[model samples]
Target: MTQRADVVVVGGGQSGLAAGYHLRRLGVDFVVLDAQSAPGGAWQHTWDSLRLFSPAAHSSLPGRLMPAQQGETYPDAGHVVDYLSDYEKRYELPVQHGAQAQAVRRDGGRFRVETEAGDWSARAVVSATGTWSRPFLPAVPGQDVFTGRRLHTVAYRRPADFAGQRVVVVGGGNSGAQIAADLALAGDVTVTWATQRPPRFLPDDIDGRTLFDVATARRRALDAGRSDTGGVASLGDIVAVPPVRAARDAGLLHAKPMFTRLTATGVQWADGSRSDADAIIWCTGFRPALAHLAPLGLRGPRGHIPTAGTRAVAEPRLHLLGYGDWTGPASATLIGVGRPARDAARDIAQQLSS
Candidate 1:
């Protein structure tokens, strides 16, 4: 059966749920389609010990209060997943799970979204699959020749998985640092971390509040068009840097400048350094999942969809969320994704009513 609506929201993450909640409240007819069987996109697939650097107070979704926790410490991945599941139930939002939209095509004045289940038509679409859907692993020369076990950050759940093995973590981001530290300490594994950029570190607390709290405040100031305090960096960057320094200080991991190539038995560094390892963990990053969105002609460069002023890209009746400060990090975060969601629904509603 073919379903029709004013909008069809792709992806069932925080952004998508926010869009659905706002759309329903506005009396708009719409349906949300999700690739995952459950909500919480990347959170469901993240490393087991992952936690948000943003505190609970600043992290709640729209129309719902964040659950009270004991300390100001960050919430874990499972805690976030639980919150998202609860948010959906509270809103009683309609979502079609496991209905992955494989391709989207334009049909006259309407958009046809083809999923594994069937085809649905909508006047507008919100692509919220997010950037993490596609893990971007660079083609290291001779990667295929490596005989050791290789895993991306997506597949790594716990450091225990690499017990008693030498692990080479290839990436500069927090994920790589954290994983290396965890494995080195818990399992006594030898770990090495490589990156092209040197990480900048920050203290964990400032003026009685946690570093996470200060970061959020800075972001909010930036979003409101107020001048920044000038001493701080982005929350994402700050969060990534400290853990890496901690891991280094603990002798849990060694930081290498960058990776040069992969050999049959190990990896070589640009500084002519080499290491023997039993495993390699790639924590490079991800690209937006838009291979299914080829018909829209929205891709700009590096296979990323280009947005026209944050609401829509080159295509009409299409909106993108979590596209890095479209509404700022407050809306970009797992907890604070509602700001853009509300904006998206409002803009989409206006377009439809016109």
Candidate 2:
């Protein structure tokens, strides 16, 4: 079946919802397509203990502030999921669940979006699918032959699953630190946290909101031809959330340089020393989910779609939200997505009206 709208959003997560809210307020007709069967987007796939980097209020979409969890300052994955689900219903966004977008292409004057559920032709398209579906694992020698259990952060559910196992956790980002701490606190898993560089923990109070502000300020200064003031990245890599702080204070977390290579039953370090690990967990990051836009041929040599703000440089009718800083100052975050979404909607409205 073919459905038509003024716009079509390719995700139903926080980004997609934000785009929907703005598009609706602008009096644009749109439908959001989600691959997942339910609400919450990737939050539904997050581990049981995963917590937001900020409090609920600081991590909310536009039109509605996320309600606080009574006893927890940093809300858990379930709390985020609940908020997203509620936000969708509260705004009455037109999101079609279980509609996985397969490909998108220019169909004459309109964009045709093909999905598992059906087809949509829209005057404008919003690609809001974030990076969760495309987990990135760096290529390491001998990793292909490692006999032990190998896992990526995407599939990880809980620390209890790794209890009593000798594990090597790789990656220097927030995920690696959090997962390492979770396993250590389980009291049974033997962990060796590995990183490309020494992990730098941000101040206890420096959370997502603060980082977003600093990053934004730095970006604007640079764009205005002023000297780079500095971004949150210059301060640290890790957010030092509650669990990581507790684990660090308790001396349960320590970092080792990443292993040179993986052995059949362990990893070998640069010093030629080896640590026997029963499992290897790659807490590496993710790439932007842009496979659906492949047919558009918009991605450049750097694997990114060139954009003027959120709108594609080549295809002005397409706007990409929530990919990262390049789309907007901090468009990937729930709170930060609001401004970019509004701008994208406004631009679309103007473009269509003209």
- Top lDDT hit: 2
User: Candidate 2 — what's its lDDT?
Assistant: 0.92
Please report, as a residue range, the 10-residue window in candidate 1 with the lowest summed lDDT.
Answer: 204-213
The sequence of per-residue lDDT tens digits that candidate 2 reaches over residues 275-304 is 999999999999999999999999986578
Angstrom error of the Cα, residue 300, model 2: value is 1.2
TM-score per candidate, chains pooled: 0.88, 0.98
Pairs clashing in candidate 2? none
What is the clash count for each candidate, in the order shown? 0, 0
lDDT of 1 by residue, 1-354 (tens): 878988999888888888898999898899989989987766788887766666665567788866855653667778888888998888888888899999888988999999997999999998877777778888889799999998788889887787778888877666676777667666467787777777544455431134434546776777679998542354333354344456667766667787789888889887877788899999887776777788877777767666653465568688887655543344556555676688788888999999
